[model samples]
Target: MSRRTVLVTGATGTTGSRVLAGLRQRGVAVRPASRRGAPAFDWGDQDTWVDALVDIDTLYVVPPIEDSPTGVPRGMGDISGFCKYAVKQGVDRFVLLSARSGRAGNPEVVAVEDVVKALGVEWTILRPSAFHQNFAENFQLNSANPLRQSIVDGSLEAMDLGSPIDFIDAADIADVAVETLVGTGHHGQTYELSGPRAFPFAEAVRIIARTLDRPIQYTEFQPTAWFERLRATGVDETVIGLVEHVLHSHDSGVFAGEFDTVERLLQRPPRSFEAYVRETAALGVWDMNQAANKAMQHQR
Candidate 1:
């Protein structure tokens, strides 16, 4: 029998990129599928899907995100349709990346999970908490995002809501994804992965501030002001709405729970927020000079 080839969609994204690295370190054969990747797979283009799935035995699906409040990107092919096609093409197993927020009864998430289950194949769904990397890798450090200016200026703006979020490291999620992809006994399971503990966003910034030994001021915006701040930053309405909803949910204490799924699966405790802050600080992403340099580069 040939070695099983796994196709990983969104291979450049936070968790997807880590998943790719984890699989590679394990010597697993991986085919990365992205719009710009070698196989050139795109969710908006069905013609690109076949080549990405060819001879693949398993899949790691990172569903396409929406730019609209509807959670459906205009002109993107249906993911359920893609799953059906994959099953037809002899892909036997699937690991889907979803969010814990979806557990709150989001219709789009419900539909995706339903289709994956109906595929009649081995499947596992991972519903993880917010990623720890978001602080370092996403809008925080990316100079293209207007939010980076605040970080560079040593001001952290947020709609705190006093939520105790259980943020998981993307690497941990990747570890779990690799295990499920290469091992057995995880099929048909839905794992809720989170950090070892939960804390408010302000506390997380405090950890960072302490690590850097600099006063990184944390400012909480009221709902109206928060919405306006995002708009001033050129954030689209859909994302703004989603952020508002998530923050309100956080205020309602929807994501205050911590899960042991990471430790149980990896036989190691989840990495702490302090660890993330310390390690990320060493990278100088939060350094004023480094962040400003990145911002300048994006401007050019």
Candidate 2:
């Protein structure tokens, strides 16, 4: 039998990076693809697709959100076309990374899944909640993230709209992605993954504060102010729209729930928010110097 050749898009991203590591650990042959990787793949550039898809049996898709000048996202620019090309290349299986917002009728998520399903191939969809890594990596540390400003300015303002979010760990998402990519019994299934429990943003920050033994104050950002803050931080409209949708979901209590999909799929309880906080805190990433170092490491 031929060995499995899995192509992972967004290979250096939060879950994609973890997925790559997990696949390698399992001794699976993985071809990492990004806009600037060895097997370079760009959604807007069809010329790069062939190289990324060659000899690949399965794809672990992390959909790109490339924004156009008009605040519209050209995700996978033409996912349908890409899927057809992959089919032609003998690729028959796909595992897509979607968000919990998909259930709330997120247009981009819906469109991507629709394309994957229409491909007439084995497909699995993972709708994961907000990633716990968001706090330590993207939200607090990543240069592009507006919330990173809070880390510098000592103003940890976020939406405190009373609803609790079940933030799943990216590692858990990667594990499930690996299983669906390599294992069986998950094709044509859509799994809604989440952490074991849900907690409000304030409580989550408090946990981090306690873990770091520092005074990280959480300020409430009303809807308008939140949008304004994002704009002021130079966040583009595409991301702003998505962020607004997510904020609406949370404020209306859509995110105040948990799912057992992680446990059901992985046969183990997902890691808790407090545990994630403690572990990340131990890494000294909350410190500005450490955060800079971590950001540099991620960019590499």
Candidate 3:
């Protein structure tokens, strides 16, 4: 009997990489399919997807970039095309990495899922909230673009997020993905993962300070006050608009469901915001004080 091979699309990302790592730790055969990675499956590039899907029993679909709300650079209608082709081939077991807010069973992911289901493939869907890795990898950090932010109460209500988001660590999400691949229990269910507890941004920042021993703070900023401060810092108009959009959304109560799905999935509670802040801080992932620190140094 041949060993089952699991193909992971988007192999380089936060969730995908963790999936790969988790699978490897459990001794499952994982073929990473990404443009520059081992199996060479580019979501936009059809030939690559077909090549990688050969003899593959399971797939972790992270979706092509264009489907993302932040707007990816991929071409139009990428999702439909990928599913059509995957079904033609005999690939089975598709696990999708869908957004917490967008996963309202959108025509997008749902459409592909439907196709896979029609093909009689086993499926599991994971809708996870905003990742903690965002603080380190995304454009939101203080070091990359220096800014003095007084924004506080970063508490996002979770229902607007399309569901309660316990904000599961990418690593935990990966563990579940690998478990589904290796173990049999999660085949027909959809799992929503989040951290054990949800705290507002101010409290989250305080945890960062406690963990890193840095005096970092989270200050609340109204739109007007935020605009003025960003203007003084000479923040670009484009960047300012995006920040405003996020703030407006959060403040308006779009994300109301925040707290504890990670523990539910992993049987162990997810890491806390403080652990993320502290761990990242100790690792120089971001100097919580680095941004304002730079602003202060330059002002003197």
**How high is the CA lDDT of each candidate model?**
0.80, 0.79, 0.60
Best by lDDT: 1
Model 1: per-residue lDDT, tens digit, 128-205? 888787776752112343343456578888775767999899989999999999888888998989999989888887
The better-scoring model by lDDT among 2 and 3 is 2
In model 1, state the lDDT of residue 231.
Answer: 90
Name model 3 segments beyond 4 Å from true. 1-3, 66-76, 103-119, 138-165, 217-261, 288-300
- What is the lDDT for 160 in model 3? 23
Tell me the TM-score of model 1.
Answer: 0.88
Error of 3 at 297 (Å): 18
Per-model TM-score, in order, reads: 0.88, 0.86, 0.71
lDDT of 1 at 234: 86
The Cα RMSD in angstroms, rounded to one decimal, for candidate 2 relative to the true structure is 4.1
Candidate 3 lDDT by residue in tens digits, 61-159? 876653233322233356657765776676667787765543443344455555445556677777666666655564321234221132112222211
**Model 1 bad stretches (over 4 Å):** 1-3, 66-77, 139-149, 227-245, 293-300
Total clashing pairs in model 2: 0
As for candidate 1, its clashing pairs are none
